[model samples]
Target: MNHVISVINQKGGVGKTTSTINLGCAFANLGQKILIIDLDPQGNASTGVGIENNERENSIYKLLIERNNLQQYVKHTKIENLDIMCANVELSGFETEVAEDKNRAFILKGIMDELRQKNQYNQILIDCPPSLSLLTVMALVASNSVIVPLQTEFFALEGLTQLLKTINRIKMSLNKMLEVEGIVLTMFDKRNKLCAQVEQEARKFFGEQVYETLIPRNIRISEAPSHGLPVIVYDKYCAGSIAYEKLAAEIIEKQKKFNFAA
Candidate 1:
């Protein structure tokens, strides 16, 4: 069975792309076939995995908008059992293009159904844009679960309310089985008293919805994308790599519980 997850945050700079790449890589290393869909128009996920946007012809944009074939667009990453669907600047136009189609909410789900029928991937991860646009909505519709990443800042919980509301709306209207995977606290600095305060407040509000693994702020994480690699691949000993590996374990445990309960 495939677990399709969308890493989403309406507020950017919360390490969404970093989490996506690291989880994909870690899963692949564990011998699972993984596919990362770069839904963000910025294409950071593509570059983070060492794929150049200019070097590709059929990206996710063409596959979504023109209903083009996905066979050529899917490319293998450096890690074994991991593949990627790169995005380009052209994906920005999908907001207007899929506007009139009522079933636009299910476009991504339709594509995933086709891919699943082919038994291509065991897990599909979507890296979405940092906004409440149609792209994000489509990603939510396509995903069975969503992982929300939050920065431990003062305004961290502000956008979260709206994001949860949107998720609830999507569940009722489009995806009845959608579930929130968990809230991951990212970019945390243990030295900052304010960060600690923010963490306490978030825990008070969200309770068990937050993950046990909190990702610390590390310079290597920010530097990895420029080098076209995930932090785990770029520097396995870095704090970011260690944190993400812990997160991967936590995620796997939760999935096991879900499976057993079923």
Candidate 2:
């Protein structure tokens, strides 16, 4: 079955886009066909995967606004199994543009339903904006589950509480099947006692909902996007790359268990 997951964290600078890109790359490396939907107005996920700004004329904004064929918007990345529906700054206006529509939240869901019929990808990751806005809501409504990238720092848990409430609210009213796939601890530093504290707290609260893989703060991960590549592609042996690869494997294993149970 094809899985549609939203990589989201309302808090900014929490490695949301980074996790989205690298995780998709890792899944591709594992021979899974992956499609990353760049829903963020920043379009960082698109840039991270090497989609140029000039090449984003038929972006997610057009797809959302025009309700066009999804295939027309999907752009293949340099990686063999990875593709992306690019986004641009114009996506920032989507919320306002659809304010009066009662079914606005289901728009992305409609497109996703079409994608599901094609069965072209093993995984589809939606890179959401850093806010609990209309765009984020659309992503949540469209996705089967979410992968939250939690930064190991102060106020991280506080922000997570609000995000959880939002998820529950949407679950009750919109997407009944929506679930949290896993929480990834990002930007971790072993030397930082605070990072350890946060991880402990997260594991205590979320239990198995938190993945074992920890994405460390690495220069290679930081440099990859500028080079228009994922860290695993940029520096495969790096700590960050290895961590994301492990995360991909972990997610795949979890999916197998879920499928078996189902």
Decoy 1 TM-score against native: 0.96
Choose the strongest candidate by lDDT: 2
How would you encode candidate 1's per-residue C-alpha lDDT over 155-261 as one tens digit per residue?
99998999999999999988888898889999999999999998998899999789889999999999999988999989999999999989988888888877611
Error of 1 at 8 (Å): 0.7
**TM-score versus the correct structure, for each prediction:** 0.96, 0.98
Cα distance off (Å), candidate 1, residue 235: 0.3
Worst lDDT run of 10 residues, candidate 1, spans 253-262
- Over 4 Å off, model 1: 260-262
Best by TM-score: 2
Go through the candidates in order and give each one's C-alpha lDDT. Answer: 0.88, 0.92
Worst 10 residues of 2 by lDDT: 253-262
The local lDDT score (0 to 100) that residue 93 gets in candidate 1 is 89
lDDT score of residue 52 within candidate 2: 93
Across 158-235, the per-residue lDDT of candidate 2 in tens digits comes to: 989899999999999999989888899999999999999999999999999999999999989999999999999999
